[model samples]
Target: MKETDLAVGNTTVGLSRTLVWLMAIISGLVVANNYYNQPLLALIADELHVSESAAGKISVLTQIGYALGLLLIVPLGDKLLRKRLILIDLVLVIAALLWMTFARELWMLYVASLLIGATSVIPQLFVPIAAQLSNDQEKSTNIGLVMAGLLLGILLSRFFGGIVGDWWGWRSMFGIAAGIMVFVWFIIYKMLPEIHPNFKGSYKQLMLSVIELARTQPVLQLASFRGAMAFGSMSAVFTTLVFHMEQPPFQVGASVVGSFGLAGAVGALAAAKVGKLQTAIGTYRTILYSLLVLIGSWGFTYFAGETYWGLIIGIILLDLGVQGSHIINQTDYFTLKTDAVNRLNTVYMVSYFIGGSMGTWLASIAWQYAQWEGVCAVGATFGLLGLVAHLLLSRKIRLAAIKT
Candidate 1:
């Protein structure tokens, strides 16, 4: 099972449609582990007798774990047998999900959340594998397809988490997630083609290369910063949304709160096609507009503190902006150096998740004091800062380009 299953002109290397779809789905489920707890935070806090703000740490811990994994584990993909890495990581994640399901104490649950975030980095492996499987002509489209699946999994995780938690218990959500991961793992083991490593150096050099790429690549920095801010803003909204709804005049259950992710799903679907959109308008403008859209989304969500319509509209726009910018960012960076995608992605994603953790942490604090208004302020501020960051980075890149 080499890359010969799908052929393009002069190249015999592209994934089959079935394999591409499988990669998308498996990657989606794997990434979903980090997010399943978002909608369950209120239930978890109630059961653990902790404050909702304390429970919010699960999201932050998970993102921290993910950032650590991106920094440490993902780079290994460039030096290891990717299929083996994926399976091994999946096994560890399944164990972590089980730990989360059976835990009796808050400390144990938080530990499990961290490990789940660490091991659930299999999707990052899959994305780079998808790029390796693709030929030059189809790379962006294939990457976008797998990315779309990952985004859908992320956007919809809350929806499913809310429903599962409401119907059974918060623990049941973890158990079900573990079960799904097992199913996907078996399928991937049976079907996914094994790709060879690209980097020729030892592990130490591979990590050093990640730093080298980060320093040399301004586009990498821009993409990473922009993604961090967009994801951070998005995180502030979802991390505390369950808390907001559970306590408010709305008083909606987890199920209803999760359903709002449907709006986000719509946005994710639209953003999945952003590869074409970037080509039409150029990456800078696409991302620039996306940042503005994210900033505007906070306005609706602010008023949404009072109305369902505002919440739904805000979610749609929020997701559309965040994911749209993300796809273009990946597309831009992937082209910078295709051979070292694993490391490139490692730098990009490590920064991205760190931003997410900060956003969740800040949103929790805002919820403690300013509540929804404070959360809205945090989200809008991140968006504005992201826009400013992008402008500065873009100008730097253009100036460097002229010199080169």
Candidate 2:
């Protein structure tokens, strides 16, 4: 067998199971920092003397920072010592979190938020490492396990942040997040093994190669586009949901807003199943199903204009669809270039974050004009676009399969 094929095949079976779990835990802690400020946006706005619209920029700036990190930091995973990179990034993230806690003005907070996003590439590093280490047979399951940790981390950060911010101060949430990072940093140092360089080239050449891969890779393009659209739509809903819940008839508290993350968590559970389904249904068909579910989710929201249960059901369905599509996209993209995981990630995630930021920005404006209906319309429109993209690509995708 070819060397890359051998690596792929051997990566799945008979690995150190304990180490797998350890990586997942460490990765989750590192990734959770990205979402810590989300649920507390309203609190941050009040404390920082910014408008809610401006505070919403926190989410955008953070995502932009993450995109930059994915572009610059993640690619180093292929060229440098992965363990060292991860450790350094973790330290940087903690420092950024500390700065956020002490941030006295808008610009300071913006700078701190950017740094936090930039260094939060820890999860990206972890996923590629897990893929590299797994045997082929167990690769998907291992990836799913690690991702489940990630999804849980994303879901719970909001809950924990809300509770901590409510009980103490908004700054306390960052302090707690920083403390968690400190603990995880040590655990990673002791437990995670170092990775050797895979692509030995100058930084310029490495970057050029990654760009070329992104430029030519159809699967990467397709997955990145689909992933972004789905994420952007999801971001639109989430950005507006808190405002809706906090205002008007609902008047829910921060804790309750944070609690809605549970629905997303329940939806996120579907990611693992999507991974398994990929082997059976093929990536394209699975994406179609996910898009339909996403659209149907928005339809539920229309009914939810008057009822909380309707909103809850819509949120759950929307999350499941979004999370499931995300897993499939990652799996598909990973298969495109085994050795170029980090760069592939940079390309895919840069596009993904763009979608997320756009969604949030547009959602904010839409919320102003159309309220909940506007948000739902944007989300449903994005889903429809995705469905159309998939159908147009279907023939070419089939041809590519035949050639393979």
What are the C-alpha RMSDs, in order, of all predicted structures? 3.2, 2.8
Per-residue lDDT tens digits for candidate 1, residues 89-153, read 88899999999999999999889999999888888887876676677667767888998899888
C-alpha TM-scores of all predictions: 0.95, 0.93
The window of 10 residues in a row where model 2 has the poorest summed lDDT is: 1-10
- The C-alpha stretches of model 2 lying farther than 4 A from their native spots are 1-15
lDDT scores in order: 0.86, 0.79
Which has the greatest lDDT?
Answer: 1
Q: Could you tell me the lDDT of residue 152 within candidate 1?
A: 88
In angstroms, give how far residue 217 of model 1 lies from its true place: 1.2
lDDT of 1 at 48: 84
Question: In terms of TM-score, which candidate is strongest?
Answer: 1
